[model samples]
Target: MKFIYLDNASTSHPKAPGVATAIANFIEQGSYNPDRGQYSGANDTALAILDLRRRLARRFGASSPRQVIFTQNVTMSINLLLKGLFTAGDHIITTSMEHNSVMRPLNEIRAQGIRFQVVGAEKDGSILPDKIEASIDANTKAIVVTAASNVCGTVMPLREIGKIARARDLYYIIDSAQLAGVLPLKLSELEADAICFTGHKSLLGPQGTGGLILSDRLHHCRPLISGGTGSFSHSEELPGALPDRFEAGTQNLPGLIGLAAAEKWLTKQETKILKHELNLATRFISAISEIDQVRLIGRDADYCQVDNPGRIAVISLDFPDRDNADIAAALYDKYRIMTRCGLHCAPRAHKTLGTYPQGTVRFSFGWSNTVSEVEYTVSAIKDLSQR
Candidate 1:
């Protein structure tokens, strides 16, 4: 039986048109590493990588292509930034709605005297810029936050927070995993020093493809790993350039190539994709709100009905009298509707939502999901609720 995929917050499915073809073509014909060799194949690979960088730079409104630093995924990019940039006596500010990608690294770096204060989010998962500003102290070095909550889909007030960061002269880094392709983002407008993004999610690229867009201000941040960067190989020390300084080791050529294709596809379909996802989410929320036992989490259903919605299509539901895991399992087993259940690697977000330890079942919609699929999932939920 075919399954309805509603767990796109974890990873996107049916990737962009031509994504598979791009990866397959690269693997089959030209699998050379970029910037490593002088042959024609190597030169071609390097140019393709450069093209991807330029595309991403223009897509995100970065200063230049040199600021686009590729990494394995957003988690790696966040780790590199958190571990490499801050030192002893430096404090950072973040929201309680962050994924483990930010929380875990911050916890690990506490051993090195780097500290962070978490500004609490409202029960609806909304954060206030004033609260963030009030939390900043003399030792505060940066403000790191996710653009939206992966658990509840509540969009943060980034531009407001960015203004606060700018006024305070603090480095602002954003985890754009949940917001990248779903929302139109410009790093300059957000006043962000860096944006960590993952390709396998909203970008609709292959799994191992993700990177960071750094502003000129953060070009001096220390590298997390040092090795051969395919440039300045004669010297034992790592290269001191923009990307080569941060990106070390053999890159994921096929994945990046696939990402380039996905980027091209997104450039054309972004408006339609956003419209569809919003419609599906609004429809699902409207239907589910009618069930008495079923509780819709995050911002009110009305928030999604606007012309420009604040949040993505990630919907989490709480079954007050039913086990969330059991409901998720029943969804897949009986209705062939796949979903994610539990903390979703974001215990802090769950805690903020008052669902910690008993996390909600999340149904995240994506570009390929249809209105019919959402309606069917809602019907299944209604039937399960009655049982």
Candidate 2:
């Protein structure tokens, strides 16, 4: 039986063309530790990293390539930013729809006397900038929020929130795990101090590839990790530079190469890919809406009609009486449809949506998914709902 993968929110399947080829080439050609040695291979690898940084910087609207700091994933990037930037007496403003990547780190640092307030989201998973502004206090230092909801693909009002942050002189940090590669982001226009991203999700890159694109304001923050960055070895202190200050230890050369390849492929077809995925999501939502037993979570009455530009192709389906995990398993065992069930690492989002304990079955579309596949999945769900 043919298997259908609908778990793009967790990690993108069928990565961008040439991603595997790029990784294979790097390994076959004998990859070297970038910025580690004086050898030609090391120099070339270092240049490749620089080129990737430059391209990513330009794409993300950074003033310089040095502003991009590589990390294992967005979690690490967020931790580095949050832990390094804030301390006792600091206040952080965020939203209920944030993933654990943001929430967990902030929670961990709360012991240091750094306080954070969560701005409640709408029933439809939308976060209002006004609500966020209302929560701001005299001690507010930064506003950290997700670009979009990982569970429902609800696009946050980034521009409005950014404006509030800028007007208040608060650092604006965006977790773009679900937004990067799938949506166009101009950090300069958003007035964002930093945007964290994971390449394994919408970026169509391999696992272990992610980073942070920050403005010059990051210079004020200290290094989260201090070790060999292949630069400023003579000094005991970490290099007070853009990337070197943040990136420590050996880099993931193959993963970075794959990420660069995926990024290149994504840039070439971003518009088309986004349109295709959104269209599929709309079609799926429309079809699913027709089923009497099926209820869509975190969607408004006008969701189907809204021209959701920043929204990705993620959808959550909640069965009032049925077990979500059972439904997901049935879809897999009976229809060969692969989907993610349960809280999806965002218990706060689930709690906001009132689907905390039971959770929901999520079908997240991607660039590789087709309209026919979406229609088929909808049909399968319709069949299961009737039973």
Candidate 3:
């Protein structure tokens, strides 16, 4: 059977051409350790990485590329914030819509005497910025949340929440795991202390290249690991700086190179990419809305002001008459359509939507997903319901 892929939220399918080309070029023709040598090849490599930083800074509206520290993925970056920024006494506020990437670290910190509060979003997966603001107290130190939920694809009220955090003098960290490439942002306007996102999703970059964009406010965030930082070679301590301070050991050279190329491609295609994804998402939900017995989660009436607007092109359809996992399994095994079911590593989010034990079938779209794919997915859903 011909396969249809609709799980971009988990990890994008068939990355952009430059993604693999750059990585392969690094392994084949561009092999040199950046910052380790003064020779031409090493220097060229250094220039490449520096260029990546510059582009990413502008991509996220960061002050400089040095503020962009490369990590394996959003998970590591989020953990870096939880472990290093929050101390035993610091109180942190998060939302029920967070992925395990953010929750696990905070949960561990909670055991170690840190205070962590999870503000709940509305039943439709919408989080009012004020809800997070109201949870803040004298002891609240930082607020960490996802830009848009991974499970339900509901965009949060970041503008209002960011203002609240700024007014209250609290650190605001946004996990843009699902929204990075699909969304546009003025990070400077958000006034975030640190913004964590991965390259694979939305950003249209390869895996193992996502990380954090930290503001100058988090100069005090301790390092989770320390190793050769290229800078300050003579000293045993980590480099007392932004990227170097957070980045330890040799960086992911090829991944960074691919990421740089991906950024260049995305910068030019940002608007087109969003419109394509939005249109596909719109077509998808419209098809699903026409299907009887299909309940779409995170339903919204509007579609503007968000990169992934209308709440969901990443639709979660609950087949109450049938087992969700069985439907998902059949969609893949028989229909050749890939989807995600169960908690999707966000049990807390699933709980918020009341889909925990029997999670809904997730069909997340991407910029490259054609409308025909949406129709195909809808057909499969209709078939499953009929069965």
Candidate 4:
């Protein structure tokens, strides 16, 4: 049987055309130090990096391209923003649907006197703007929420949350790990103070390419890493500007090149990307709902109970009689179908779903997946029920 890769929530595979080619091109023909040289190759390479940055800025609708600072991944970008903004006695407001990426760091920092309040989302995994607003106190310096749940593919109402954050003078940080490709993000309209984006997922970029977009409001946030930024070598501290200030050490030029290509490819297929993913999710939901043993999660689009209504292409099913691990293995061993089974790294979401110990079998779809692939996956699940 051909492999059915359904673990896109982990990372997207079969990257866009030219993604690898871009990486290879960068490594072979375009390799040059972005900084510390006035030679033609170095100048040309730096321009290439800047060009990618500009594209990233445009992708997120960032007001300034320089604000699109690259990092190793979305987690790194989150850490960079969280560590930089949070301080002693500062309280942050976050949603309960957050992955370990947000919770782990907040928990670690909370031990050091940094405080945080996690407002629970509704039963369908949608967080209310009012709930987030209510959690804010005088000491609350920021409100951070996942732009979409990685576990369930539920998008959140970040724009409304951003409004509340702005009204309360709190920094609004969005983890855009799952929404960057499947949904639309107009950073300026959303009032997103910062958006942590990964290139490997929706952007169809290679790994090691991700970034955070800082709004003009955060003029005082500190840098998580202090090193040579090439632009202020005379000083010992990292540069206190966008992009350059946060990006420390040498960048992954090859990854950035791939990222640029991926973003370009995504731009060419913007409408198709969203519609295709949503249609696939709808199909998965429609097909899986018909199965007696599998339970579909989330709400109907017309009756959106969550702030960000309607899930993306990730369909998580609860097989009550079967062990999640065993079911996952059966899919792989018997059908060559790959999927993730467990809490999906977001224990909070599982606890919300009341499936903490027994995580659901996650079938996350992407642009590369076809209708036939979805049909085959559904057929495999149907077959699994008999065994």
In model 3, which regions exceed 4 Å deviation?
A: 304-312
Q: What does candidate 1 score in Cα RMSD to the true structure?
A: 0.9
Local distance difference test, candidate 1: 0.92
Better of 1 and 2 by TM-score: 1
**Which scores higher on TM-score, 2 or 4?**
2
Candidate 3, clashing residue pairs? 181-202, 181-203
lDDT of all the models against the reference?
Answer: 0.92, 0.89, 0.82, 0.83
> 2 or 3: which has the higher lDDT?
2
Q: Write the per-residue lDDT of candidate 1 for residues 1-387, one digit (tens) a residue.
A: 789999999999989999999999999997999888889999999999999999999988897899999999999999999998899999999999999999999999999999999999999999989999999999999999999899989999999999999999999999999999988778999998999999999999999989999998888788888898889989998788888998888998899999999999999998888888888888988899899989988986677743657677999999999999999999999999999999999998999999989999999999999988988998999999999
> Ten consecutive residues with minimal summed lDDT in candidate 3?
301-310
Candidate 2 per-residue lDDT over residues 231-337, each given as its tens digit: 99899886888788888888888999999999888889988887788788878887888888989887633453324564568899998878999999999999999
Global Cα lDDT for candidate 2:
0.89
Q: Candidate 3's residue-wise lDDT over 1-387, tens digit each?
A: 678888998888877658888889888985899888889999999999888888878878898878888898999988888888776788999899899998888888898889999999888888887778778888899999888888877888777888999999999999988878776665787888877889887777888888888888887888878898778888986678878898888877888888887888888887887777767777777777787777777764355334437364566778777899999999999889999998889898889898878888998887678888878888888888886
- lDDT by residue (tens digit), candidate 4, 1-387: 689899988889888888998888878985988777989888888888888888878878887788888899999988877887777999998988999989999988887789999899887788888888778888999888998888777778888888898787788889999888766787788887888988898888988989888888875778777788778778886677767778788988888889888888888896776777777777777787788987766654333222334677776788887887888999999989899998988999988876778888998887888899889889989888757
CA-RMSD of model 2: 1.4
